[model samples]
Target: MWAAAKEYFTHPQMESFKRDVINHMRGLWRTWRSKMNCEHVKNHDNLEDILNDVPEFLIKEDWEWLVKEKFLCKEFKKMSKTNEENRALKTMNQHSGRRPVRQIALDLEEKLGRPPTVAELVFKTYKEGDMIKDDAANERHAKILEIMESNPDFTALEVVEAILGEQKRGHVICFGGGLRPKDLKSSTSTKDATDANLEAQLRRSDEEKEALHQSVIELKGTVSEQAEEMATMKAEMKKLQEMFASSQNRQH
Candidate 1:
């Protein structure tokens, strides 16, 4: 309550923070799984070896909750599908001749390198962020969350990929390119390119601003120097003219 009062986590900021938590937990799960065949380690002995590497982002109690909540996911083969994912894929499939939009979405997931939209929805509940309220997609996201609870190692991207498989070429062009640029917003590679361009542009702008500021400072100094020189010359010329007039009067 106090943290919310302090505005420590704005809505978007909280979402960003929670995304990190998902990334961290997913990483820990992958590390744990990697030891399945290591001769020096016992995979089934306990989760202790893996849990020990928990990052500072989570406390001891948080770790346990995450284990129960995000880790120990259900069997991949038996897991249920996400409604949000299903709906998204179905929408795509409807556009194409394909019977299952999920397959095409998974194919895109692999090729496009993005998580299923449904999986993104599930992260909200797992992180308990500011956007944890229920909506049309909540039920579907909940199913995915339950699966994650049991099979923590399976990432949202992987879950979608498993059903979609590696062959992207054969799938129907379901979810055809967005009618405009806004549709391309979800593409990670595209977003990365755009972000890079924006960053470079911002850097150049800053540099230009600094250069202009320095030039103004230099011009001010130059103007002051010129004014002093002009005043001195004027005074000397006036004295010379007066002296010449005095000499002429003496000659007369």
Candidate 2:
């Protein structure tokens, strides 16, 4: 049994397996740690802790070997794991129920102190498969239109929820404005406009920064040149003063 285990651990394939297992374990530990009120752990610190905690699961000799072969330190591995988890968590949170179509619209209205338009709502929730008929998402499109006509202030996200909630036949309703190619084109154009505006603002800012930097450089150069000129003037004035004193002494 010892020989078999040792052989498996030494095998090249086992290196991949070890990485998968360690990564999974690290993920679980992070989740557990987050739920707790402990201070955030640094990568190296976390790896050291993991090594201490799971010495049996991750044989120290094998781990050291993997680290040497992979040219990755324990801390680096821990940092990589932490980064992956952070990204996954961010994605999960962003797609969470908080951003439902209806809710997003309502929030926008509340913030803007006005109702949103149907086109705006349609543009927000018009994912490719969202308009398709399924038992889970039926008659959503028609409902969105109905809601928009009825509630000018309602967000597109809100309209989607209302339609989905009221659906009975599991029939697909392509949101009239949402499923249209023109609507998509409009949305794309809107995004392009926004991007252009942002790019213009960034360019202006960069120009300002460059101008400021140049001004600072010029000021420094001018100050340095003035200092040198002042020094030369002072030396020449001292030499003239000495010559005048020497001539006066000679005449006396």
Candidate 3:
């Protein structure tokens, strides 16, 4: 399919568009199938009718195997039930709906002017409107923040572990299973670099503040010396006036 479609991408900068599309094709297909299963397949009574309504991209045999051998099997049913229960445990509402969580992360990075920490990204995506849906999500967000603050060098995976009490092998929870450990690592690296730059800027500001404080102290000292000199000059003038007045009285 890509071989035939690649010709339409003629722009020079879009040379890699084919590669990008191919890389994302699996995720897109999974999302599409999940939507179809939830909205139509599970609710419909006639499995034969669904088989007949198979997407054009899928061959008839393949569609039949997926519907009968895969989705309808006992193991798959058990897995689906487990997934539903797990989903029920989640307290935070998904703000993205059908949209991908990865896209939300990209939008956040663009809006924030830097790569957001994992905690920040989780909070933004999990929040419903202006607030989190329940105490569970709020507590998770708070814990993640505390861990990150206490250990600035902790990776995203570590932060998740500290919040959830364990880090599982595949996807990180609250991230919608879109972010993997490697992805989190990459984000952490970028965040660390940004944080380092900010720290450097802070150190420079502190140096400037200290220099200004010292200059203020020196200026106060100079002003005090000038005040003392002025007082001495005033005393000398008064003594001269007294001496002149005494001389004038004696002459009279």
Error of 1 at 221 (Å): 1.3
TM-score of 2: 0.27
Give RMSD (Å) of candidate 1 vs. truth. 21.2
**By lDDT, highest first, what's the ranking?**
3, 2, 1
Best by lDDT: 3
**TM-score for all models, in order of appearance:** 0.26, 0.27, 0.53
Q: Which candidate leads the pack in TM-score?
A: 3
Which window of 10 residues has the lowest lDDT sum in candidate 2? 170-179
Query: Which runs in model 2 stand beyond 4 Å of their true positions?
Result: 1-192
lDDT of 1 by residue, 128-176 (tens): 3545444544554555556656655553333333333432432222222
Clashes of 1: 8
lDDT of 2 by residue, 145-199 (tens): 5776776555333444454443223211223211222222233333342233334
Question: Cα deviation in Å at residue 91, candidate 2?
Answer: 42
What candidate 1 gets wrong by more than 4 Å, as runs, is: 1-188
